[model samples]
Target: MDTASTNHSPHLHVLHDVLTAATYEASSAMSVWTGGKISLTLDCVREVPLESISEEFDLGMEPLTMVVLTIDGDAGGTMILTFDEENGRGLAASLFKQEVSTDPEWTETEKSALMETGNILGCAYFNAIARLVQAEFVPSPPAFLQDYGPCVLEQALMLQAQCSYDVLICQTTFLKGEEKLNWHILFIPNPKIGDALQSAQ
Candidate 1:
């Protein structure tokens, strides 16, 4: 988490800026929601190799709770937000002003809370990208998954193969005060959106 990385591909410079701005917006929205200043740590925004994603994220076979949002229109691809159970329950508890649930099964309210959080964060992220690329980007409702991190990520990568190999890695860890939370966001933009970003740059 301390190491910072960047891709020097001139083709990716504009894209990095777009994703960075999106993270900033997401941080602001989170701060407003919590009534306390919160920020997302952007260690690097780069084009990550598909094959290296598992190693890069240290995903291994660990089960993680994640949200996936598919995007369509002028831009395309999917966005994934991942966090462990502790972080997920803690976040929901904060928003709902209730104790974190100890149950293994997610209740209807818990699912709704987490998905809504994903919607807020995804909207903030896509809004920035749309502004930079000057294109329409529509995000579908979030789908929650509890499975091996690498498995979910692999499915996402397979979907990306249909469009382009340009997978953008925007590594962020949510921060409340000085404490780092186990939240991360990963997204891949299809060629259509990639082209728009390059042209805009």
Candidate 2:
């Protein structure tokens, strides 16, 4: 195992520039989806212990709307997109072009909207990475859930636990026109990707 690849900080240091470069592609991807201009930027990224995942988002015990995507390939892992109630509803409403339901339960339309958003975001990153690593990266259909933030992260982390003690996490901010979407994507890459990334360099 490469210590540099599994370290708690620099594990993603190599990715900062790569992700920054991919920002344009990600933004373009979203813009096409929304049928208008959209900007997506990588806010921050780092490697952290399995248990410390929730700390990155300053999440408490609050339940959150989550969309989980499993990236399957030679090197694969999970990507989790999460938002609190206010932001989640706001996003759903934006896509619906109308007010969404106020009930705690998410309607089928709401679930589909969220999943499609997650899929778009996940594929943008995966597509960029695949080009760099020269490997096909496919994401499963996003799984929608409403649960405690930590609980959602736990399920995502479980997928990568066998790959490494420290997981690489990235935070992305997306905006549609002047509206800054308060949504986030937490990426946990499989350790096997270290080879692909390193070889690319």
Candidate 3:
């Protein structure tokens, strides 16, 4: 499992295709689920050293909400859905058909709604992975956290960090009513899966 030290297969194009397709599905699914109320535009998916994730998201010390789901079966890793407190509440309000609140504390109802939203998004990408790789990719029950984005990301990366110092992250920006909402989805691929993806090419 020492993926960091192992020599990776020279199959960049194939790996790129896999990431591209999966991310596209994730964005599309989100759009459909929102009934076009929210539109998602994604930047290119990129792999960077784990330490850089905090800076990549500009995750300062401010508290934010994060939902995590673990991918199992083939290449195992985690997926993170993040939203700042304001946007998180806004999303929850929209889901519940209620007005957005300014309260910083999340009620139980809001937390549940956010977790379900995460599950939907996570399943979209997992479905793409399963279809492309022709292998079972099961997503675990979602876990919710409210903390500094960087702090929450550190927890998400802790297990993956054991096998590799680098991780793959894809960022998607969500727009509502022509205004971009502060929401992001990050995909962290397991090193073994990373190897599989490249070698499959």
Best by TM-score: 1
Clashing pairs in 2: none
Q: Rank by TM-score, descending?
A: 1, 3, 2
C-alpha displacement of 166 in model 2, angstroms? Answer: 2.6
TM-score of each: 0.89, 0.82, 0.83
lDDT winner between 1 and 2, please give it: 1
Which lDDT values do the candidates have, in the order given? 0.76, 0.72, 0.71
Candidate 1 per-residue lDDT, tens place, 70-139, comes to: 8875467677888898988888887888999999898888887788878988898888887876767778
TM-score, prediction 3: 0.83
How many clashes in each candidate? Answer: 0, 0, 0
- Best-matching candidate per lDDT: 1
lDDT for position 178 in model 1 = 89
Off by over 4 Å in 1: 1-4, 162-166
Residue pairs whose backbone atoms clash in candidate 1: none
